[model samples]
Target chain A: MDTPIRVHGLTKVYGGGFRAVDALDLNVPRRSFMGFLGPNGAGKTTTIKIVTNMLSATSGRAYINGVSVMEDPKTALADVGAVVETPEFYPYLTPMETLHYLGELRGLSSCETTNRGRDLLDLVKLTDWREKRVGKFSKGMKQRLAIAQALLSQPSVIILDEPTSGLDPRGMVEVRDILKQLHKLDVTVLMSSHLLNEVQEICTDVSLINRGRLLRSGSVADLLDEVKARKIDVRTLRPLTPDMFDRLRAVPGVKGFAVTGDLSFSLDFEGEEDAQARLLIELQNLGLMVVSFKESGLALESLYMSLIMESR
Target chain B: MMEAASVVNNRERLPSDLQQMVTVAKYDVLKHLRSKRLLGLVILEALLLGLTFALPLLLGVDPTDDPAGYMSAFVSWVEILVIIGATMFAGDAIVSEFQSRTGYLLFPNPVKRSTIFVGKYLSTLGIIVLMLVVYYGVAAALVFAMTGGGTLLSLYSMLLACAYGAAAAALGFLISSVFKGSTGSLVLTFFTLFMILPMIAQLLPAGSIKPWFVLTFCGHVISYIMISPYPTDLVDSISLGNGEFMEYWTYYPDIGGSLAVMGGYVLICLALGMYLFRRKEMVS
Candidate 1:
């Protein structure tokens, strides 16, 4: 409750028994960039919608800066800026005019809103199109504009759902760059994304969920440590037969194995570099010519997959 | 060029409910101004006013000998203006927010849903008021240019027309809140107010039973107020040549009773519409 954002026992069962979020509890620490990672139906967007007070939960409470979102949403969301999904603005309005309307609703003065809105436009790289109608904008452009609006109030907490989902590679980098600035500003950021590497790069903490249930929540460093037990892919100069599969499985600290290619296979190993070195020696002792041996994917991605699989 | 820290210390108080409502309505009004529907209303008004002027000049049918009669000719289309204005402004007010997915940006704000609804309602009524004032202003000027004296009954008729427009807009908002698509809501609102209710009003004519409670029936006061004492029900028997007779009658609404009926529709529809809007969730 004392955190910048806290969701406790939140359950949202939509009409027709679709349980979008179930007893989902989460806390975003102050000044921490939290990555809310989940699969397609993992209730990430639902939780964001509830915390932003866009959708009502079936039961339980979500608080912003200790203010209850349900009991007093206006106060709870005063310092919270969010983009829950692919948000669309009025096509008739230019960026500046749209900002005026929203800024007025948020009790910002005209001069202040204009000045801040210009800054946000520049931050999102949209200052050139401030006077143009939003109707002509592409999806990526709108996504950037959405980010700008979320930061217009200089909110203490920022929630973004797939902020870079529709962007080109350059646009994605630009948005990520803006996000990096938020880290320096010390804004509590809760961004939901399927891009694990991006989360690994920008987030300090993460809470992964699956099927409306929390799988794991901790700092990115701790999660990486949990996944130091990595999946190492090994390649050979010759094809492996059944007897070789048996000998490969017999190695110490190798928990799982899958044949990725005719001459290559992946092993789920359980140790640091020292254990990896011993496994390489054991594989070479099996009398196969080793070609390549390396970690397969990112540490957070491995942790995300293992936790999500375990939850299922 | 923009300083986040400079504004961080300048975060003022959140807006009051009234201020929020005004903010919402202000943009909604801007939307109306920018839309093609307002242009459509303007065209409708110009056509109606042009007919009023050209008919009097071309056909030499100047009823300006009597001020009420001349003004009645101009005010005859008042019902259509109100109905069209309601259809244009209020018909899609609530549904467009949902259908077009604008609710995503608008609904999650710190502003309450009730405030948004009231703001939109005021915006609709505001347009209706402006339409009535302009249409009547043109009509009053034309009537004055023709007739030497002013028409007092036209003023009462305009007042009734404004009330009737408000009730119509309220009903339109109710339909908008209940429907999913803008086209269906707009069509249904215009059809229900202009076609269905008036057709039903025909069945319960003045002689036997009065549909005094019907919103469209009450809307008759906007025009019928010009008729002194509001002419009583006329039941006439038509003679078929072979001694077969058919009965037909005309219906007119009383001024006071019709105003009361219009007021009732406004209160009921406004309450019900606002309640539904507040309870609605932004599903998309």
Candidate 2:
């Protein structure tokens, strides 16, 4: 029940009066995986920046573990570690040396620093390249090193701004596993990504914002149930007549239906299991060649599109 | 209860913030040492000393013929070489970090910006001083072996050279922090040091602005040791007088005044650079 981070009515305006984020509020519980999902230019990154105290919030408040980022950033940031965009490091330095420098900044004892550095390098699967200069690292290698460094202080809340944007498929899998592993350690993770599937596969909760406004925020299950109450897709062997389609649409609890494809029809209802039995009976009575029917999980792409479309 | 107690004990060992800043500083100094840039600069000082002796021999200039005039010209050439090397080194120190995007990782830590600034600055100055010591050794050996006209005045002049070298390095650090790119910072530093500042000094009425050239401060400080009429026949081969002031200010030389001016210029510029860097948003 403890809130690790809270952003209240946050808004940001750029020069010449362009609003990037407006009237946004978010609450991330401690030790939860919170995904921030939106289309490009939807204020997802802006929100992360404001919460991390990188970009100034025009009118709002942000607190990290009850410490206001505005009132005391030095103390507030003490528990927060962030990797904004491409993580930069001294090219001439090896990954181990880079960690040693950052460890010092995080107050690690020399012995503890070396031990932690080696452990993290091994965790990121970079122990083999520990002494190699970072300049020679590929983009994926550099990103993995960045993640290890972010975890160096054992921060309570870790924020990653599109941490896996440009990675290859293998790299994305590596990053996803890394995030999942961190989640096991009781660390609160706030990640922003335009990749919907990445968010869908990993996040326990999500907050969607668009056009400088908060569209929706909740656990993936809650948001899915709220927006997808009556949507069901049924596949049949042949196209149905208009009268048969109308009858199905006029069912007591059915909200809507659409022939989305040649053999598949989308059925939307007013409530969960509202008329699910009645729906099956009607299709059976009509002697319709029903082949297969399925309910979609809370896929972020659908939720994201619905949220953005409703806002417009 | 035992598990809970162990967990509580684990949290107590976390490092405090000041300890972290020192660690970051130590890492930066170590990286510089490994790269051997400091050693290379010190070797430059040795090379300058060698040039002083070798050039005279190569051109066949008799040391006994006008020893004072030959010594003055040699001092100026060495001064120019020292200034060039120190400026280039200082200018690249901080700006290179920005260029490489390394500041993004370091600045976001729990440490204060001033800690990073002072740590890097002092480490760089240490390297310059190392070079100065080497230069001094070579200069002393050359003075005794080649001229046999060695005096304590020559030794003191070398120390003054080191002081001026430190000043130049500090000034370059300030400029490096202001400019964005390494190449741009270097070009601007050299231009300001050589072309612009002296030109401005020339534009002012002769005595009204000589102290403005940091090189002028060096010229004055060096002239005091080499030009002052001290009896060289003394057993200790040491004497002190107010001759550097005369060479620098000519008619209106003030040694304390020159030191104060140079000190003021260095302090103000460094303060301004730090303020600018602290507020700057690193886009890279």
Candidate 3:
């Protein structure tokens, strides 16, 4: 039995001929952290909603843990935990109470729910706000609580739709830390996000989708290897003037460049190590003292955009 | 570590349908209470009780005499309480899940949609019942204290009130299932119960047709049951020019018939409401 999250010819044509998800077939292997990556309106959320059984497909099928969602959602989703589209709570329930409510629905006893709730809350770092009403908490706090609830049932498969979306930088880090902890567990995670860096930090594999269709999918390393292009960040001791920007863009092997800070700019280059070394010498010839030069680590971002353009 | 394994094992086991309903009901009760909708209705009930006892004193009318008539005055107020309860608790039972996106949190669970509908319906009905019981309990005690006469008829009225509440709340749930926003559901449910149905009942009885199909029409049984001999329909006619007559009519609902009408609403409206709730998607 293939217990991975699988969607075959899954299509969702909303009212008025809007195809939110069009025959999107994806597979997240067992115990693999697969990033369902795409731009906004790329059918990522629509596919996730279908997989979670929150919305019916126009046609085709979705399965979670080897059970067909459209046929028997209750059983297909029994071992699945999903947070879809910026989930909101009852607002009146406290974090602890929310966990208990969800835990009981999953068939845990009072003692077990309590213990699991406490452990989950502690894991999400929401213990201090355990008794606080969710309505009074900020969006970040609610997002963190969402993580706690998703993991409360100890589900074998966890689905998160933009878990770090709409959070401040600090909140994103907090949620990322929790996600990192999940990566250590024996659970399968199928998280959807528009940002490549967000999933690249933790996901084992990624699927690039666009306009309701899957464009490409593979291991994180394989996808990165497919596109050797990178955006390198270079910080200088002295700020470059307007003319200096023109000269910097003209450097050999430097395909493009943008001003990042007063003393720094990012160079979009595609080349081997010899061309990259020549780039440093070119910058030195311009009388600029290089403070730092390194890759920003968003290789798949370039590939994602190029595929979206080609798919169109 | 051993305890952790046991906990994990416990979670893997799915609960029975009945257990899921109970769990959903339990949490729904907490939602209503924590939202203060239940408490607000109770406070309003207390105020109504206060007004019921106070209005008579201020008007210098003694409830001690004709205790049956005095207690019967509560019938109209109880009807209003039931409407308010239905509007507040049941009006948003299903719509809020979609409008607020809380469905994202709930719909993914292993529980069935029918189970969620019944559980929420029970919780809403339970609150209305509690409100009715408190109102009737006080009225009954006052009537018992004022006279040693039997308050048997008031019990019937209270039972009818609960039935009416159930029907009205089911109607509210139906409206909630149909509408997409809280305000729209609340306004439609309140007006449908408080004004629209009663007006229809009034107009229909003029044509010698009982609006027995209307739940609010049957709700009048709460007060009419208090009147002895069970009042029947009344008619008054005014002679126009040339001996033409214009007839005006007043209708009283029958206990058995009206109870059946309300029961039909409880079944049909809930069936329809559950159907819509199950079919509703969490899009947008």
Tens digits of per-residue lDDT for model 3, A1-312: 344698899889998999988888898888789999988889988888888878888999998777899988888888877888779888888898888888888887789778878888887788898998888888888888888888877777889999999999999999998888876677889999987888889899999898899899888989888887789998999877877777877877788888888899898898888989999888878887988888888887888889989999
Clashing pairs in 2: A104-B20, A230-A269, B224-B244
Q: Considering every candidate listed, which one attains the maximal TM-score?
A: 3
Better candidate by DockQ, 1 or 2: 1
DockQ score of candidate 1? 0.50
lDDT per residue (tens digit) for residues B1-284 in model 2: 11111111122343554555455556666666666556666566667667777887899877654345445545655556556766656777678766876765665555555566767666666665665566656665566565565566656666666666666666787888888899888877777677776565555534444434454443356555567662221112223374433222233224455556566656776687677666555443
lDDT of 2 by residue, A1-312 (tens): 388889899998877998989888889888788888888888887787667655667899988878887776666777667877776777778998888777666656668668878888888889999999887899899889989888876777788888898999999899888887865666788898888777877888888888778788888777766664446788888776687877787777777788888877887665546467777778767777888876654345667887789999
RMSD of 2: 6.9
Candidate 2: which stretches are off by over 4 Å?
A9-11, A50-53, A56-60, A229-298, B1-21, B34-47, B64-82, B92-98, B147-159, B162-166, B206-224, B229-254
Better-scoring candidate (lDDT), 1 or 2? 1
Candidate 1 regions exceeding 4 Å error are: A231-297, B1-12, B60-63, B234-249
List residue ranges in candidate 3 displaced over 4 A: A1-3, A238-289, B1-12, B234-237, B246-249
Task: List clashing residue pairs in candidate 3.
Answer: none
Between candidates 1 and 2, the one scoring higher on TM-score is 1
Backbone Cα, N, C clashes tallied per candidate: 0, 3, 0
Ranked by TM-score from best down, the candidates are 3, 1, 2
Candidate 3 residue-wise lDDT, B1-284, digit = tens: 21242214422588977888988888888787766777787788778777877887899976667767878877768888889999999998899999988898999898889999999999998878878888888877766666656477888889999999999999999999999899999999999999999888878866878677778888988988888989997888878889899887777788899888888898998999999988888888
RMSD of 1: 3.6
Model 2 Cα displacement at B256 (Å)?
2.5
Ranking according to DockQ, highest score first:
1, 3, 2
